[model samples]
Target: MSWSEACHLDRSLLSLEHFFSIPPDYAQTLTGGLTNRCWKIVTTDNKSFVWRPATHITKAFSISRFQEYQILSAIESSHLSPTAIHINDQGLLVDWIEGESLTDSLSFDSLLQTMIKIHDLDTQRLPLAPFNYTARVDHYWMLLSDEHKVPAFAEIYNRWRTAPNLADVGLSLCHFDLAGYNMVKTEQGNKVIDWEYAALADPRLDLTLSIDVMDEKPLEAVYRYCQLRGIEGVDDWVEGVLAWKPRATMMAMLWYLLAYQLWGDEQYLTQAEKLQQAFCS
Candidate 1:
């Protein structure tokens, strides 16, 4: 079923009455979600919160609302994320920071700073699950139709699947999706919104995606990141990110391809083709 259909069905299957302490004055569908459904809720007292509806497809996207809740709880004191309020098998609710999304005006340095704070949080005992890179990639690949599965796709997949993960680098709390759409500029400061893809993993993965999305030079971005994080061996870090670039690109390519297959959106197809050609060329 399409996302809209699932959401419509969920509306009938799920109720919002008991989830809240007091009845909300208003609730509306919040856009920008590609796969999941979220609602912006305003209580009688004028408090605003974001409610992410729980769905069965969480497994499909490798998302765990439970994990997200834990991570948010762990980092709540850091003030870099929204405060987690209530969570259950039904859905999740959190305070919605009032601000504009970092869509058109992305501040790369600001994002990096907030991200470093998250990385600096001691999560060694958080019990959050590690992001299994190979498993996630394979899941997306498996979702694609055979017609969309080009030979180069498998070849690239195998190469990256067998390659060694950066074992030398320590794992930290990484927001796998740091795109502008997931960031917001609140009155206090920048706050990252989505934690569906958050995990304990190689910090370089976040850095890799950050640099790619920011369209900044890889080496320069790594240098800046190292400088801010007080991480030495800039050249080595650069090398690690570069080595992981193709793997990251492959994962993005497969995601777009699968998204196109599921939704039949031309934009996803265009992006998938672009990513494919970049590395396949």
Candidate 2:
């Protein structure tokens, strides 16, 4: 069914032509969106678009639609992502790239190249900050069942709180969430979506996250980042990332559990349970 048929798009401003110029005739919810409600829109001209509507904040850490648009506008044409055309009360509208996320075999060099592009982009329109690992962890941890608490919490918290977290790491735009969900491999090349969590921070944190999610050796990424940027004395920085790993785990655990709570999806619940066990062990 068309966008008009599936839902009540009662305003002319919300019409397909208003956004895409071509009338879109079909709309279906896309799978694996995980964070927001995304719909695949097929236009009468045969072009495809993604329609994502606003949802309430799921976790307490950080995600701002307005910030996403600002950063995106800065780098929209850098070929790192799809083109952004418009933003309405409904949500932002951008050209939808057809591709798969870079999950495995995320070549070190390729990943570094992408990171370089992001770090090099002119970002005068935005303000960014260091990764608030502690706040995010605390927020997510509060969502978990008390009985499932990790025994190492106090030990981990005290040491992590005092350690150097690279808070002063040079500020630059970073796609903070480098997990596969934000990546897509199209015929055009690799592209990252979901700008809601992008911010300015230590580019190294992006590197550390890339290592964590891609299941690659941390030293490999740290070494490459150092080589590319001509930096040194990252031992403390690397240690900061390692210290924050448990919180990363907690973030995942809470996301999955919350997914289960909201959608009653058993897969998410199962994954949450597994992560809880892993963290406590």
Model 2 / residue 152 / CA error / Å: 8.9
Assess the local accuracy of residue 164 in candidate 2 as a C-alpha lDDT between 0 and 100.
Answer: 41
Off by over 4 Å in 1: 1-15, 163-167
- Predictions in order: lDDT: 0.79, 0.65
Clashes of each: 0, 2
Error of 2 at 146 (Å): 7.1
* Model 2 agreement with the true structure over 167-269: per-residue lDDT tens digits: 4556567786775667787787778887766777656666666777677877667777767766677675566567556655656666676666667779987
TM-score of 1: 0.90
Give residue 116's error in model 1 in angstroms.
Answer: 1.0
Which whole-number lDDT from 0 to 100 does residue 278 have in model 1? 90
Give the TM-scores of the predictions, in the order they appear.
0.90, 0.78
**Weakest lDDT window of 10 consecutive positions for candidate 2:** 154-163
lDDT of 2 at 271: 89
Model 1: per-residue Cα lDDT over 1-281, one tens digit each: 33234346557214555665666666677789886778877777888888876675566676778888988998888788899988877777888888989987887787788789888889866887677888888888887788887787777777776435454777889998786888888888888898888898888888898888888899888888999989877776887888778888988888888778767899999998899789757
